[model samples]
Target: MSKSATIYRMVMDGHICPWGLKSLHVLRSNGFAVDDRWLATRSETDAFKEQHGVTTTPQVFIDGQRIGGHDDLLRYLGKPVRDPEALTYAPVVAIFAMAAFMALAAHWVVAGTLFSVLAAEWFIAFSMCLLALQKLRDVESFATQFLGYDLLAQRWVPYARLYPWLEGLAGVLMIAGALHWLSVPVALFIGSIGAVSVFYAVYIQKRELKCACVGGNSNVPLGFVSLTENLMMIAMALWMVAKPQLL
Candidate 1:
């Protein structure tokens, strides 16, 4: 015999509960024949909640065993739940992935090619802008975190605050293929300082720290990832100077 479950969920004209849909989908995906009970109005939902002695809807029952809401349902199935407070590299990874996609898409549209010297440049520039935006979202927070390990930022408070703006401006100028004289110098100066700072803090000092590369609220561990960001900037700066000569 097949497993069976019943779910009481909110389904109204103006609003639909996403948790309810998730619950239904989970049950069906797990090979359960679900008896979906839709609470169509405010009164109906309230009445159901009162009858069941529960505060929330999207309640699931399997063989008279109550499986609470979406989170509870996942627990019942022995699934790993996401912890929002946990430290993760997800933000940085997502930004890089998005930058790569955007670079490829822009190159395809303009150059009728998937790969080129210009596309590679676009990828790095786009990543720099996106990463800078994350830090700029809350400059004070970013600066505080940055000062913890960044050598230059610790000595010069204003540099900590202005770093994101400088990074973003250089990226924009590079992308526009304008003001190479300004962009190249900015990228090189900051990138060299950042690389030296990160290398000393993480490798030489062997001190563990959080990366300010993503933002102030970032949970990404400082080390390889932070070093990579600076190195890429340095490479891009040098490339900007040499590319014209080669092409």
Candidate 2:
């Protein structure tokens, strides 16, 4: 068996190929000797592709057998594939994680302590603020997508546009520990509406649609995760209303 590999990759002065560099790195890291062949011009690159009958760049050959391109090389080495289009809960997880950390930090700064019921309140409030900010980044797009599932947004078109700002205001007020009368009712109303809408859309209607939660472009499904988000808001609202003693 041959222990050597040759890579045909584009490497012009102004345009260095990323996959070519990756291929070289992978080969070297795996203790394989590499014959570096640079297609330095468009004509040379075209000719190389034509000769190999492959459509893409950074072609690798090991022991005179075609081992294919960058992704193929990773597969050959038994590495995990990182598909860009793969759906994940990573974004929501990251957002909540950051919100929790921020809540703890804020609590520590204000009260000179860590982790209390107030800290939990702050966490939810911060999460709401962050989520609202994400939606507000492109409110028009968010409103357009939200109309697909949100019952209120469907009837009152202006509600979709106003929703993010309302969420943000309620969150900010909660963080300030002020205007409970306004914030509590706002949170309860919105959260209740959101929960019912999500339930009806996912369970009753059985619609397979992307959630406008997080952002308009998010791939998050309109289901349990979304319902949980709304439920959290409702719980927070109720907690605020019932816990005047805690305050």
Candidate 3:
């Protein structure tokens, strides 16, 4: 005899609640025989909400005890609840992972090979452009956060504002394999400053702060990941200058 659960979710001709679907999936995956109840129309959904005193749909009941929505269900099952505002490295990790994947794919598409020295170059360039785009979404916010610890940004406020654009442009040019004259110098300059600033702030001053690497509204902590971005740019810039001659 499997455990029995009842779920009330919205399902209409024109619209379906995604959370409702997720709840149903979770219930089934947990080995529950679910009595899936549907609120087929807005009026019915409203009526259900009024009757149950819940503002949202996909309410679950297990063994006659009411469990709230998705988050509530997770809690009931002793699972970790999702917290969007918590400090996390998820954004940077995702960007780096995707950039590496795309770099390999791009190299394969262009050069008819799955692996190459060039893929590493593309990975850094792609990561830089993506990270810059995140900062570009709210330049003012990013600048304010950046000014907290960047040595050059502390002395010159305008550099904080201009950093994202420089990074983006350099990354774009590097990806295109054009304007080595411009991109190489830009990457080297910013990367050098950023590396030094991060090193001093984190290692020397030993200050803990939020990184503006992801964006202005980012919750990522400043440390190894932030330093890695600058180090990658410096190495990439040096490679751009040297690879041409060595190849």
Model 3, runs deviating above 4 Å? 10-16, 39-50, 53-56, 244-247
Worst 10 residues of 3 by lDDT: 77-86
Instruction: State the TM-score for model 2.
Output: 0.80
Question: Which residue pairs collide in model 1, if any?
Answer: none
Candidate 1 local distance difference test against the native: 0.94
Per-residue C-alpha lDDT of model 1 across residues 142-220, encoded as one tens digit per residue: 9999999889988989999999999999999999999999999999999999999999999999998899999896889
Better of 1 and 3 by TM-score: 3
- What lDDT does model 3 reach? 0.93
Model 3 residue 134 lDDT score: 95
TM-score of each: 0.82, 0.80, 0.85
Span of ten consecutive residues with least summed lDDT in model 2: 82-91
How do the candidates rank by TM-score, highest first? 3, 1, 2
Best by TM-score: 3
Candidate 3 residue lDDT tens string, 187-242: 99999999898888898999988899998978998888999999999999999888
Q: Of models 2 and 3, which has the larger TM-score? A: 3
Model 1: residue 54 alpha-carbon error in angstroms = 6.0
Model 1 scores a TM of 0.82
Per-residue lDDT of 223 in model 2: 87
